[model samples]
Target: MYHVVIGVDDDVEHALACVQGVTNLPGDAAEKEVTLVHSFTDNPSGASATQIHSVREASEYLEDHGIDYDVNESSGDPAEVIIDFAEEEDADLIVTAGRKRSPAGKALFGSVTQSVILNTDRPVMVTGTARGSE
Candidate 1:
């Protein structure tokens, strides 16, 4: 089985992008084991990852697409949570989304997607774009 970690935020579009990334995986969808992770970057109320709309939407999409998955919720830095979870799971692929940011932009905002892509030894598949043209 191919272990895949998909990191999603509250954004539904971004979550769909991650789902699309999984859809592009080779072989059968049944061969993939997916774990959807969401980090509550600033959850004062403490929420479950399953409560996030994007995560729910992605789960539904995956179900309809014949993919099986599970959800994980965590609290902390988004990038760190994602990276650590991926490592713990020994993921074969990491799926995520990020807005297109220039060197200056990224340096200023510190993109989670950028960090995951750069820090992991596993293959990464990124989907969607802020501009949709980049």
Candidate 2:
């Protein structure tokens, strides 16, 4: 079985889309396992609304497709957390969302997706933002 780690955030649609993309990849869907990971920029007492919604949506989709998966959460740098988790899990692939941001904004604030992609040796699949998101 191949282990796959997918990074999720407040954007439920983008997160779900990335998961769906995995199943569509060139391979037997049954041979892949998914791990939904959330890296909280700000530490919260409990599960945030976005995290709950994202995980719920992902779980439902995985369940419907009879896929084995689990949810993971960590607090700190988003890119660092995701990369560390992927390494710990010995994942074969890492999926993340590429937010809809202008080039200037990305240059100013930096990008978690970019950081992860640059740092990790494993392949990364970055799903673009949904059509309507800002």
Q: Which candidate is the best by TM-score?
A: 1
In candidate 2, where is summed lDDT lowest over 10 consecutive residues? 125-134
Off-target runs (Cα >4 Å) in candidate 2 are 48-51, 129-134
Candidate 2 lDDT, 1-134, residue by residue in tens = 78889888877788778778776677676888999888888765676534478778877777777778888888889899999999998999999988877999999999999999999999999887544422
- Local error of candidate 1 at residue 36 (angstroms): 0.4
Q: Residues 30-57, candidate 1, lDDT per residue (tens digit)? A: 8998999999878877778898899998
- Tell me the deviation in Å of residue 99 in model 2: 1.6
True-structure RMSD for candidate 1: 3.1
Evaluate model 1: give its TM-score: 0.90
Mark the regions of model 1 whose C-alpha exceeds 4 Å error after superposition. 129-134
Native-referenced Cα lDDT, model 2: 0.83
